[model samples]
Target chain A: MTLKKWIKTPKGYVAIAMFAFLIIAAIGYKDSHGIKNAFTAVFAGVIVDIILNIIKRRKWTLPEGAVITGLIIALILSTATSILVVGATAVFAILSKHFLVYKKKPIFNPAAFGLLFSFLFFKTGQSWWGAFGDLSVWTILFLLVGGYMVANRIHKFPQVFSFLGTTFVMLALMGYFNIGDAVDALRPPFINGTLFFAFFMLTDPPTSPAKDKDQVIFGFLTAAAGTLVYAAFGGLIYLFIGLCLGNLYTYLKKRSVSKSMVNRKGFISTHR
Target chain B: MVKMDKKWVILCSTAVAAAYTSGFYSTETQAVKMESAQHNQISLHTKVQQSGTTGNIANYALNQQNKKAKQKYKDGTFTGSGMNRRGDIQVAVTLRKDKIVDVQISNWGMHYSESDVVDLPGQVIQRQSANVGIVSGATYSTEAFTDAVQDAINQAQNS
Candidate 1:
């Protein structure tokens, strides 16, 4: 289909809205830092998308989801990070969406994968930007507003809440242990970068678990894994590692379900 | 129109390549700065005399000096407290020696947990140079812990 026809679809509208909102928000805040980072992110996404499409013999067009994800990640990361790292991460994200799975199905959240890859190999650091300058009051208000909006739209309130609640309780236990003031130090993870990842990145429809029960399981497991890694390593990269594991688990479970369905259909056909 | 003129594809790719190159070069320079900072270390020592009548004052001075030195250096420190490590409060203070250094508690009870606020010592040394920051989150523990360390320093000075 032509770009015009593609833009008329529901997914297209969502993508467009996300893209426009991100750009406008970047502008509205008059955040020169965010705006500059956003530009590099979008540019990187567009470039990567075009290259991938070309390789696959498809017509090149910007994927709105990729752009929005890049913008959000940029907003959440520290300005101390160079634009080059941001752009490299965006490219990795788009490429992972296209190439990191069998057939056409994505086996990982592209943003999560890219962030983890950047953390490990690129040594890119993240700062909590969505918390509105790391101001506690602003962080809380933003979480309430942003969390509610995301929960309502995605119908994943239970998953998000359970993940946050469970993680908070676990960290509180660490605080009880006096493990480097885990509870107070842990505020940044919940309110800062990972909040955006939880509400937006991990909850991507195409990449996340489909069933409600499975999603709850996915959420808790992701949080638990993240908490464990953070406790062990004391770094920011483990959050992405946890989410990636959740994505892998979801993929495996989906494959098993498909296999079972096929077996059932074959049994009925043979019996009949 | 003739497959929408594929010429723009080449131009776009070139532009992206240029942007990537510029970004990479600039970041490589910053990465060097970060590496240098990581390896940088600072060390300083200050002496305080204790009045024979009140050794607490000298201990307080030494603790304050250590914190101030760490802050001045903007580097981490390594400090230890308590006699023979079997005390209600044994702490380690790591300092670069011009500012308040990172503080670690080697031993403390559950009651002491609240008082072991890290930022308090760091901030106190930063602001007052010789005073401790208010352990807003954990008051009693901070006082007991800071005073105990101060006492150790006073003994060192008296000796």
Candidate 2:
């Protein structure tokens, strides 16, 4: 389909609306310390999308994935980071979306993978400004609105709920144990960094499991693993690692199911 | 039919097992890198010194003299060195009394080049200012550089 056709789809509209909200929210929050950093993020997002789309040559359209991911990256990075790093991160996100997949299924959440790559290799920070900001309330509102729209489209509410609830419970227990001030630090992941990631990044359809049962398992595992990593590492990298692990499990499960089905069909045909 | 499906189940389970093993290996590899990165970014080469006194009266007099010098200079520079598996960092920091003035950092170590860490010192210096903000995406490096600079400042003050 042409880029225009793709943009006209329901998913397209959701993407556009989310991008608009990000731009507006970013501009509104510009007065906050290092608000100007959003420009670099937006710029990086756009440039990376453009380049990737050109390479793919599928009717040049704005990459909603890159835009949202870039905004999230920008929001998380400390205000002191240079714009160049933000742009590089955007490029990494898009590239991961394109490159890190097997059997036509993506192996990781593009944005999360990008952020992880930056953290591990590029030494980029993920401050998650949305987690601690003056306009945190507004940020939460934006997430809720965007999240409802995206979740409604995919009918993945169970997955979302399981992930969020499991993560909260795990962290709460960890906090109760007084493991490194876990309880005091335990807050709604939905409020800030976790919300943005869970709502947008984790919900990517291609990379995530499709079956409802599988999704429930996948989401819970993702959250549980992420919390464990956070406890061990005491940073945001654990979040991405958790998601990536979940993706790997889902991918393998899907492949196994399909392979078995293929084998069954072949055996039945040969017998008949 | 049920008997045959058992084989399929076994195959699927085997795939899962293989994938789990691969995932574990990858995670292990990534974890090593993460740990090394964190180590490379922090330093513990710190020193502390205090000025010698001629007498009680002399100590007071020296304190006054140092205070004037500090006021007039309004800035002083500090330098320190540290190493990790990745490489070594020699950090220079300039401070205006309690405020940071400027920072110059040089690194000699590791598979990663100094250019990878050059901006780190500046980030540390900038964020040290009262009006400074956190560097975008460069959090660990900033911390590493800042820690080194703090060590240097402590050394200078003691001297």
Candidate 3:
């Protein structure tokens, strides 16, 4: 599809917003490394996603999802990270979307899964720069407004609210009890990162729930699990782990509902 | 029976969470600021006492002698820890003949690569001082490293 037509779609609009975010974030950095890292990640994401699509469908396809994934990874990672590492992380993210599947759908957010892998293996630092975290505190207003628009447009406000609410409550409790390092998440960059993740990654339609109640549960589960991980291990990967676990819950829930539907159909047919 | 909409639930939860978090964060930050301020005042008071009156010249000479004497290490390896917002960093400093022979970073909890601050330890040994140039990309890591080295030097002086 042409760029003009694509922009009219929800996904294309989101892609354009993400690109705008990338440009804004890149300007905050001291040097050209920010743009370089973003470029490398996006380039790698596009190439790998195209290859994977060709392999799966035996035809060329424009990979919007891959581009978004790349931009996210670039934004999250430290601007000081090597270009090669950025590219490798993008490839890994795209690879997860292609390989880790359940019922022809990915069982996890590809970007989250890939970022978790990078944290474990590469020890890459995540500054969450793409959320405009490095800039002045007023930039949070931009994140909030943009995120609200996206969530509202996608009708994922419940999911975003539940996740953010649960997270803040958990952080407050942790701070009150002096439980763990999780309380540091209340600060900037981390707060911005959490907001970014909720708006962009958690609201992923296919991996999350549709119904309002289910969406609330999904958000609550994700925040609770991620907070627990932070309490235990106190690492940056907790957010990613939480999102992946929530994805697993969604997958299982979907499977059970489909199974029951099949059984009900079989029962009626047999009775007839 | 009246049923609340999902939107109400979301709005309520968000408000409560925000208020609770802000309350806790405010108290914690205030406490930290107060504690640091007191610490700074105490250090400043000590500095004023050390440089006060005609005794300043005598004190300066004595302080220099004491500093030179205290700078000498007893020749062994010591480990020290420095903690920041990110996490703790532990470093081991090896000393010989009243000079630092080697400094090794044993563990760090920062997000940036270790390679970013790898040159720091070498600089410490060359200068025989923990006040090394900060790494371009790893400001926090460098601060933590220097603090850890300073902690090790303190241990060496006490030993």
Candidate 4:
């Protein structure tokens, strides 16, 4: 698709926004390897996506989804991660996108799934450098603005707001209570990383709810589970684990809805 | 079988609360142990310094001369720990003839993979200094590792 046409789509706009983030983040990176790692991830994502599409006999299209996933993985993973590992993560993310689907939609956020995989298998570090976690706190404005634009384009404001609100509220309560390592989440890099995840990953349409009510519930569950995990385990995987749980909920909700619809159709046919 | 009903909600809440309480207690206990260890080390160092100063003039001169002849690091194995937001890293350093002969790191908490930084122990040994320059992407883990190594060096010098 042409640039003008593509810009009108949610994926295109999000991709552009992510690239903008990558630019700002790379400029602030301490060394030259930051951009190279990102490139490796993107390259792997594109190649794997195209190959999968071919195997599935789908029409050739720009791998926009894969690109976004690659960018997210690159941004969240530590810049110190080896190039091979970065590439492998992107490949795993794209593969999960193709395979881990229900009714033609991914059941989990590919980036989050792949990141958790890397963490478990490779012990990869997460610096959230793309979110400008390492940079001065003022740089968060860019993330906020970019995130707002993407969320608006996707009409996921409800999910984004609820997640962020619940997270901060939970964190504040924990801090007030002097809970286990809860105060740390309120600090610079953790806060930045949480916002980045809320705005970008939590707002994934296929894996999150569309209705405002369900969105609110989903957000609450995600934040609660994530914060609880953080409080209990105090590890780097809490956010991703929380997100995966939310995805599971969404998948189940969709399954039940479809089941009810099928039963309703059968009853209508019998009555007719 | 997961349900979004009140019963499920209550059950999950209770479980979460229990986990949080347990975690809080565990963390508190660890913090107290760390603090106590630090306090004891400080007290011991002060006592040693005070004892050295209270000796006779001739003994003090002899001790000074002996100290000047002593190596910067006593050959032995020493262990130290470094902590960061993600976790604590413990390193065991071995010194032979005032050179760092070996380093072994144990990271029970979340940190970078071994491949993330190429041969961190080798770097420490090659440089013969705890101030091995920061690895670009693994700054936190590097800092923690270097801190632990430096802590071990401090112990070696004190010994």
Which candidate number would show the highest DockQ if scored against the true structure?
A: 3
In order, the Cα lDDT scores of the candidates are: 0.56, 0.59, 0.76, 0.76
Question: DockQ of all candidates, in order?
Answer: 0.03, 0.08, 0.21, 0.13
Please give me the DockQ of candidate 2 compared with the native complex: 0.08
Error of 1 at A260 (Å): 1.7
Q: For candidate 3, what is the DockQ-based docking class?
A: incorrect
Error of 4 at A235 (Å): 2.1
CA RMSD of all predictions: 16.7, 12.2, 6.2, 8.5
Candidate 1 lDDT over A86-205, as tens digits, reads 888888888888988744778888878877777666655555454343444454455445544555455565456456555655565565554533432344333355566666666676
Model 1 score (lDDT) = 0.56
Question: Is model 2 an incorrect, acceptable, medium or high docking prediction?
Answer: incorrect
Each candidate's TM vs. the true structure?
A: 0.59, 0.61, 0.80, 0.77
Answer with 1 or 4, whichever has the higher lDDT.
4
lDDT per residue as tens, model 4, B49-159: 464532122343355577876554578999877656544568888987666788888654433455644577788887776767777557787877766776676677644
Clashes of each: 25, 13, 0, 0
Ranking by TM-score: 3, 4, 2, 1
Instruction: Report the C-alpha displacement of residue B36, candidate 4, in angstroms.
Output: 18
> For residues B1-159, could you state the per-residue lDDT of candidate 2 as single tens digits?
011234543463355335334433434444356456445434222112133321122233356677864332225786755433222356776766455567777444221234545666565554652112334444434445545555555444423
Fraction of native contacts under 8 Å reproduced by each candidate: 0.00, 0.12, 0.16, 0.13
